[model samples]
Target: MSRISNGQLVIAFLACRLSSEMITIPGEMVSYGFDRFAVILFAKLIAALLYLPVIFITLKFKGDSVITAAFRRNRAFGITAGIIMSVLLSATAVQTVLSVQRYVTDTLLNNIVTISGIAVITASAVYGAVKGLSAVTRSSVFAAAVFGLLIFLIGVTMWDKVEPDYLYFSFINDRSHFLKTLISEISMNSEILIFAVITDELRSKPYKTVIYYLPILLILMEFLNMLYNLILGPYMTKVEYPLYIIASLSDIVLFQRLDGIDAIVWLMCGIIKAALLIYCIGRIYTVCSNKPHTTLAVAVSGFLIFMLCVILGSDAGVYERMTKIMNSGIHILLGGVVVPLVVLIAGRTKQRGRVKKNDENI
Candidate 1:
């Protein structure tokens, strides 16, 4: 497959991150309100620092995922890397499915038999995964356009509702609260793992993925936070889905309200994210198994995610699984930071040994 364009990679990942944020509306982020501005700023900085290992590893092993590169050097190391990423990414896919289920149930379907919703989402995800990353990223352009129009509509109709008075300023007084919120914000960024694993090889200017992504995400999130604080003000706390409420406020024609369109756009983004995850899983499978059985891999990955969603159901069970994963921060740190760090260190140590041998021979 041809390399994924950097623009496509950036937009696709951005949509996934933004969609996840909109659906999640992290309690810490909502709770902190205006004060979250500082937390977000600091969190992005911390995230940038954490991303260095993966970024530099790409420079060393260009055109390969860390696992692929490691596997080339040491089969055992690559297998270990593959296993860790496979587990984490599979969990990530499940989390995406569960989130999509919750979003569609609470907003779009608002009915029973939520399993049907999971079926549709996972099924579409499989199709996208089968199409491969290039096709998936291309579809992201369409999803992004839909999201952009939604934002425009929201801005046009809801601007007057955004009372400057709704905004307020106060630092979080509790040190523990601030730290916890910071960690939560940091952990929510599973997109980094996607970039680390895939985009490094795809983007010609690999680091720009982070450069183009973080600020855009931070700005978009801050804008949404501002909307929550500005439009809903104190009343925002009462609603489970503030984005739904924001959409409901817009008086669009045909649909008569934007909430339905809001759901569709979010659903599209969710499917796109799930597809990306499944595709990555397939790629990892190819690396581990040493066969280009991408089609089989995608099928199996989709099946696995579908089974997980079915088994988990669509209630407190899914919620608890996702919550534990997010709260722990281990998945993000290990996959996004530690694994790449290992690759970087191993690569450098090997390079130095080569240099020593060359000098000694002289």
Candidate 2:
């Protein structure tokens, strides 16, 4: 099968990571501080630093996928890592489904509308995954182009309304709160895991992936934060969907509002994100079990994830899961730290054995 190019993966990855932030994160930023822009910038800096292990993992397993490398080096360790990854990817997929459903129902459309929307979204994702990573990557590139154009239009339309004075910095008064929020923001980034798994799929060097990704992600985030604070000012934190509200306020000549277009873009991006997770799980399963169940695995996983969305989309359940995921260090610990460490150790051990055998032959 053809592999996804680095450009395609990066575009898809960015769409997945940034789509949720367009609406949800801007509001949460307000609760942290009046200088939420500065706080977010700082938090992003922290996240960049924290992404080092992922970079290392990527570099270490550049020519092969993490799962392939693990299995080649050590089967026991491969099984352990595979199990950990399956659980983590499943959780991530479920959350993505639930969150997307919630966003559609609460912000974009009615409950009735959400049913059709859910069906279309889930079906599209499964189809994309079944088509393979290359197909998803191409679709993501197209989605990214459209999404970028829409974002550019919004920026141009809203440029005049932005106030430079709103970009003020203030000391973080609550140290504990700052720390907690910083950690939460960092942990919210599961895109790194996608990078780890897709190392072999990438045609480019692994280190280049992080180099290309983080700066763009950080800059986009900073731009959105600034835009939110500049236009919304004191009212930024008061709204539930600040980005949507911002888009609604944009009045172009022929187009009275861009909110509808923005809604579609968000949904498309969300599906790409969810489907990418499903694909990752399928890839890991296929490699670990030494079976070619890619299409079936993705279909079954997508179905289960959609069911999870229905079950977990309730207020209390979503709040519980979201809180646990955002606040917990499990993602960072397992995906970021432990998985990479295992790969590194296994790789080194295999290399050393080769060296010893060569020396004995000499």
- lDDT by residue (79-146, candidate 2, tens digit) is 77877887787777766666676677766677555446556677888888888888887877888787
Q: Estimate each model's TM-score.
A: 0.94, 0.90
Off by over 4 Å in 1: 25-28, 200-203, 314-318, 356-362
Residue lDDT tens for model 1, 1-362: 56877778889987787667756554534565677778778888998898788778777787567777778768888888988998888888888888888888888677857678888999999999898888898888998898888888888888878889878887678878788778877877777778766853484767877888888878987887887788888777677778788989887675578887778888888899999888888888877789874788899989988988888764686678667666567888999989988877887888899999999999
Per-model CA lDDT versus the true structure: 0.80, 0.73
**Error in Å for residue 343 of model 2:** 2.0
lDDT, candidate 2, equals: 0.73
Provide the lDDT at 115 for model 2: 49
lDDT of 2 at 139: 77
How accurate locally is residue 357 in candidate 2, as Cα lDDT from 0 to 100? 100
- Would you give me the overall lDDT of model 1? 0.80
Residue pairs in collision within model 2: none
